[model samples]
Target chain A: MSNLPNVPFLKFIYKPKNELEKGGRTEIPAPRQSSEPERRCPNCYKSVPLSKISANMSMCGCGYHFRMTARQRISLICDTFEELWPGVVSNDPLGFPGYVKKLDTVKVASGELEAVVCGKAEIDSQPCCVFIMESYFMMGSMGSAVGEKITRLFEYATMNRLPVVGFTVSGGARMQEGLLSLMQMAKTSGAVRRHSEAGLFYLTVLTDPTMGGVTASFAMEGDIIIAEPGAMVGFAGPRVIEQTTGKTLPKGFQLAESLLEHGFVDAIIPRPEQKEKIGKLLMMNKAVN
Target chain B: MANPKYKSAYEIVKTARSGQRPTGIDMINGCFTDFIELHGDRYFSDDRAIIGGLALLYDIPVTVIAIEKGHTLKERTEHGFGAPQPEGYRKALRLMRQAEKFKRPIICFVDTSGAYCGIDAEERGQGSAIAANLYEMIGLKVPIISVFIGEGGSGGALALAVADKVWMLENAVYSVISPEGCASIIWKDIKKAETAAEYLKMTAYDALELGVADEIISENGLGGDEFYTMLKDKLKAAADELTAFDGLADARYKRFRKFGSYDEITIETEEHK
Candidate 1:
């Protein structure tokens, strides 16, 4: 309706901040130190610590039991357990050279088939398709497979009346595939569009590393975007920013807290409290049914 | 990110370029032809995110696709925050195709985080436009060259950068994903971006090593005239070099033909249930 200038009003703050980076999370290192908080119920006051918490069962603390990894997050929210159908597993549609081997290797090591797992699932007993990015899978860097799965997932989510919940954890697009990998940003974002047109809610949970392609598209497209506490989200990283610009980023530059300060992240939830938070959000949207 | 030890990204590129910020439109001060600025995807409206048309650098004819970051706040809104919507890419494709039809060489200046991630852009088919670019650029029968003059990011940058000769300023980065995205995915903490950047290998040097980028131009300074001078000369040389191929159009087309691919073998079953 109005004439605009010819400039990219926005530039990729290449290394925009995400959460996990700034939460003072000192790595316990492999063979995690005893000082670390073990698997205790995230919500309950019981101090058993997390080490003993069942991976599938809800935390005794907050009565919220759900899968934790990026892959699990998707299945838990998007798929029906008995009929969870994952879309195209990590396949190198790009043939970007050595990308196949890299995918295989990453798959073998991470135990997740691909960077993203998408398919039919039930939320609050409502059958809806879901797309979860396995952070474990190549750090959830979107290759053609990830993109295709997500694109299809959105298509399916909109086709069905079920609200779309994307438990996203990604490093961005897959670099091994080069240009093809970069193209996923459009493919996946396109799916987000059709899904949004139906007026069905699309909930984007910005897990760790939800930057680059993931953030640039669906993560930003969510009707409501919820981030986990201390999660990292941004386009570029601190070291690269440091190396490129020769500046030390602020103490909490890429942290979720920092993003909240910048009006980037809507809210930050701890892992243990995620299920309840998700359940509540789903219920609020349930009135649409 | 105001670390004192190193020059800013703008400074680094300016320094490397011999002290000129190679921003869109600004570099023309030294010497450049004022090409007609085309607008819109011919759909809803022309996006200011992309500025394309016939231009001359040092009297040599060229088709230029400059990512407009918008000069003013109002301009940014019209262009979808300077992130090209599908229309921008469509317009770019139109211009690129035009250049190919006339056998004119194309020069693209990329500096966007990604395609427009806004509501309207999607409704109008941003994805399709980007996809069309991917499909077309690879098979374009013209000598196409792209430079990450500022920030080469996501699908928006890739749409124009599917070129025979891709270049990045010393400080420019061409990455499959951003470090923040990577850190968030791997560590669930955006703070781990520094560690992730190293792992993702998202730098000009990395792209060069991977054969994704053809060359890395070392700018002479952080910001001044020398950089622009070098840029024009180098760009001119690249144009000349591409022109010398004789079968440059065919070569460019073949280069793109080798681009899109899926697996040749069947996928195996996985155990990560």
Candidate 2:
């Protein structure tokens, strides 16, 4: 427990021990274990040991970039992340079926209050506000809580006049919240506009499967938009599009490389070098300002 | 009576979707003069679904952006059934920004079934493009007047309609989702689209009642000279009112910020009760 990052603080907030037996929800599922030490690379189709992949920061030999959790991404990109608004929790406004239960389950499963975790951090000694959406948490769906947190983060960045670096990964708006979820698109976009109006720099790092309402709003409003290699960035998912149009899509459609070619994304940066590249950009922006 | 109340949602829907109805092109041609059409998003191919350009609205230099539903079958196919692609939204934003730079008022005609739902559209970031338009438009210093001339469906319409003043024609309908889509999602039957349309409350009159739209212009059955005259008058009045405001950007931002409603309920404990 002591070895776990921010575990003590999270335990204090959740009161897991006391609430677990009373509600029968205290059990945290253990991490999955593999039968073998090696796993096949989806891109290269080559057997690679999990240890080697972890050592390489989850990059395959054939340039396939494995998705990372928000916590893992923050640790890799920032020297230290001081979390903001950690106590903020979702009110589950609509009381949609199983919504609160799902939130609790995801909270325990992902060790996050919501899909997004945002705060101030330093990349290569350059300070900036970092918000990372964890795909494991409800597929990084944007609900009222997630939207509010992001808006507040942008407000904080604006007030402090700091650069903002956001790593976005989502399936889109949370359908459980109904129109409240959809409204987040406007709310977050409004926040981004205010941030931009202040002349602060914003960089969006699009990760695997950034789609739906998330793609429409703040994700596309960045001054410089970057994406991970092979990351799927788009509005509607390919399956929906295929079903709607009844046409087979071209190979590598909606991939980051394709977006870059279309001039939608500024560049595709690998996970390992992302910190250095972003830090350099920040420094350049700082000099100009 | 030039302003006849619609009998049913189905009737209004049918009229709005009819081929004989005046489109964005017709409105531009009828209401504005010396119109010069702009092209391309500069990042991708030009989307013909959204037609925009600089034009003179009664001698006032204004930027005109409209969602064009082509009249001919080939033109409709080319325009993606009046649904905008990512480039279409991007092109709108590009033109809107240009309007801002030149201190020109913007007049947009909302007449889309919805945003395009194609593989290439999604791949290029359709949602992002639309959202970008919404964001940028709110901060634009120039006055913006958006009129829903036909079917204003979903977020696709909202992308262009986030203006200082939002108006709708008598027969137009603006809703979060299409009637068929709502019916299929809720009742699992596309046949219930008429019922769903009623439930959605998307008519221009309903929009005005809900405060979602500022006003609804009365279009007589003639659909020619009278309709154009009313539309032009409304556009001039809206543009004039917006131009007189000192803080257009702030007003625009505040207008969108105050959009929905919610209620708070408190629970009492047994002891308190």
Candidate 3:
């Protein structure tokens, strides 16, 4: 440990093909066992995976492509001229039960004001209210603050006569605030009513583990519910439901594909296609916009 | 302590008049003269979440079917988390259809957010039960009066709330979803439920204005003890008055029809439409 050389420098010197020339003779060091490559694909062996074979397909050597994150989502839809609006946040109130303490701890660990990021942005420059929820914060649990922010945002859209796009990801109610936490569902639902009353457009996108309060309220209340492929969107989760029923759920029970076939979501939007479709919706609503 | 009881009906309306809110079963038991707790839907099983029975409110014989949002973990489990599975709603349906057969007035205390959304519920067809309730309850021959005491969520609450007159306690809430759920969707954070609360406009007052709830039950100097007592009395009085309504049954159907429509202007109007 005491004589360990710099890793980058040793990496260059230890190149097996580049042997050192010392005293008129070339000396090659034995290959390090640590240099062995990691897991290989059982299928057609390839090193660089995740490279797309076509526009809509991800060609992975292992035949596995990961689900997209919320950040990757927004950027994909709104590139170049995509200007994300300033975000809204939540603060604590109703020092009920263990809520105040939980919020304090979550803020430092999750580094976001609220789980959702809301602002004015465009799908191809369409003036719309965009809200994207981050699942990292307290499992994107919704409380009064989150509820009120969304209500105000909805109300703002209502007042402005703008369309709204919401992406949801959550575990369930905060549960810490008790009745106060339960109150948010009504609050946001009311805002949605006002928004709909104003003849404004609103779309809800459900994502992985989108259960509990989110599913109960406006997440499922949209005119057009959209979901990413394989996303789970329901009130109680599948596992909990399975445990309660004691029957094995059909494959992709609450998955986006299932929801689509069942007529819950209008489409299973690919990550790449999300922007274009939203832009198209914005365009359709543009006459009102 | 009857010797030292507070004087006047107003005094009885205190929060600690009883120290806690009355359970769905308890509320009916205390007010009614002959309380008979019935069980089960012949189709499947009984649901304790909704206690269906025969009772007399203010000397009037009636059938009561209530959506019980249970208290405590054990009660919650027993009540299926206060979310009526298909069986519970079906049980209520059986009772409702029976009430219709007897031409008895139906009294429903709604305190559930919605039908159980658990997997067992879905597999057993919770949505179908809820939809069936909405459909059948609307045309029941008997007069129906619904009281929103705690929560009235989605189809679960609606199963009971499809009544001639829907009344809400000053603090009760009724909505398609709860605020925490909305916040989770809109903010991606459940802790921001306070914000969700502010946004949903879910207060009884809001429902009253929106035509969702017909009237709000004024506490009238009430606290925990007498809250339910005063509420039950007021509810009893209200239900009695509704029977005098020439078109009470029609009113019930109209109330539910309001939730069906969605109104939104085309985006073309955003600029100049």
Candidate 4:
């Protein structure tokens, strides 16, 4: 190891690009009054009007699913939702360079102080604690704030003796927070264990791109685990696996369908039937506790 | 002031990754007696990346588990460079549960870049396996301690590290992500890994300050008999103290519960402030 003097460690923490704020996704420009905007499905390669897709719960005509915001998820699944801990936010405890600015940028872009939105909600009159992760917010990265909110949500549910319904999507532990972010995995798992030991139910719905630290924690700890169709759920990202193993990936590798076949996911629930299915499951579990 | 021996955090990262450093098997062989090797997750094949079994810590019976990266090239390949598959984690948990049943303390040595990233491993539910370990290990009802002997990488290292006391060697580095990966993802340049390492604060000293690690063991006589004896003594002391305690599971939960750093902002709290 070369002993170099004055390594500019601070400079290495670069300010995140604008694209990263939207979880590395390019937004579709608003359509002109003359014609409605259409989004081309990545899987099927067919263009459909944004309104049509929205009416179908963000699924394309060809069965391709698009990521939804946390609020959109809540509106679709919850009949009545009273949010909890809306004011909780991150403290940038590590003081990592560019973290505060990145958080500020992501906050404005996603309209969320953190990646997860926690609340008490009712689905078909079945009450449960719910947390929906915001894919638009730094890719639903699990940092101190995200972890704390989820832990508190579980603790609250435990105290109230209510079941939990969680929607998970994440790149992994937030690198900006470093090891503190890694610790969140253990912390959240501990809380999840306590909640389960209290005989409370946990239903986890893994959304698209649920990988890394989040997958290795509460996302897979659910008593009954399900996934959205085409959701990529795995501990390692596909690219990382391919790079490390030097092997060509099979079609549909790490997809929700693959996980279902492998017995990790109980079912692949589409957006339209998700509410009815989840409500029924919750109601069925209601008799157990 | 920064430590004079390590001018940069990246230097510590390199040292921690060095092949010449003592591996997990070496520590197990040198520190304990009557080591009987255990294998297999029962639900699946045994993973070579993690080795665990019953061992005697001085005169006390204990269960020891370690992620072994091996010393030589062939051995490293056999151990998959210490990156455990889901089965390895399951095997470790099996041993942990067995230890609890037998009323023996549990000890783990972790040194891994991360968990195995392959199609077979993923097919076997790597994420669920690790998640199960974290959730189950918390309420094991036994004295558990984990020591980071080398690189502690993300969730993989964390699976076995949810213990009453988490110790790290002076040179060990633990982070949410490897510096190289962070550099490539954040900076779009792998060569800036040194800078990323510096900013990550992954060294043992950083872990101590961040409250991630409970203590750091000096590597003054690393790989030597004296070093093994000292580590054994420390392990015995921790085990004795932990075994005598009540409510072990609750104490372990509290140990991890205090990790995160964030402030809750609400109207009443803001007014009080």
lDDT of 4 at A286: 73
Cα lDDT tens digits for candidate 4, A73-165 = 899999999888888788787777788999899999998889999999999789999999999999999998899899999999999999999
Give per-residue CA lDDT, model 2, range B170-209, as digits (tens). 8888766677876775578999888777766678876776
**CA lDDT scores, all candidates in order:** 0.63, 0.80, 0.63, 0.91
Error of 2 at A54 (Å): 6.4
Better of 2 and 3 by lDDT: 2
How well does each candidate superpose onto the true structure, as a TM-score? 0.51, 0.76, 0.55, 0.92
Please tell me which predicted candidate would have the highest lDDT against the true structure: 4
**Preferred candidate (TM-score higher): 2 or 3:** 2
> What tens digits encode model 3's per-residue C-alpha lDDT throughout B1-273?
010233221122222112245557656765576888899988778877888889987787788887665556677678765667778888888888998798778888777756776654654545446545654666676788888767666546766666777787665676545666666755789777666664455667656665667787865543354665676676677767766666654555444433321112222222100
**Residue-wise lDDT of candidate 4 within B23-82, one digit each (tens)?**
999989988999999989999889999999999999999999999999999999999999
CA deviation > 4 Å runs, candidate 1: A1-50, A53-67, A74-79, A82-87, A91-98, A286-289, B1-260, B263-273
Model 1 residue B75 lDDT? 60
In Å, residue B204's CA in model 2 sits off its true spot by 5.6
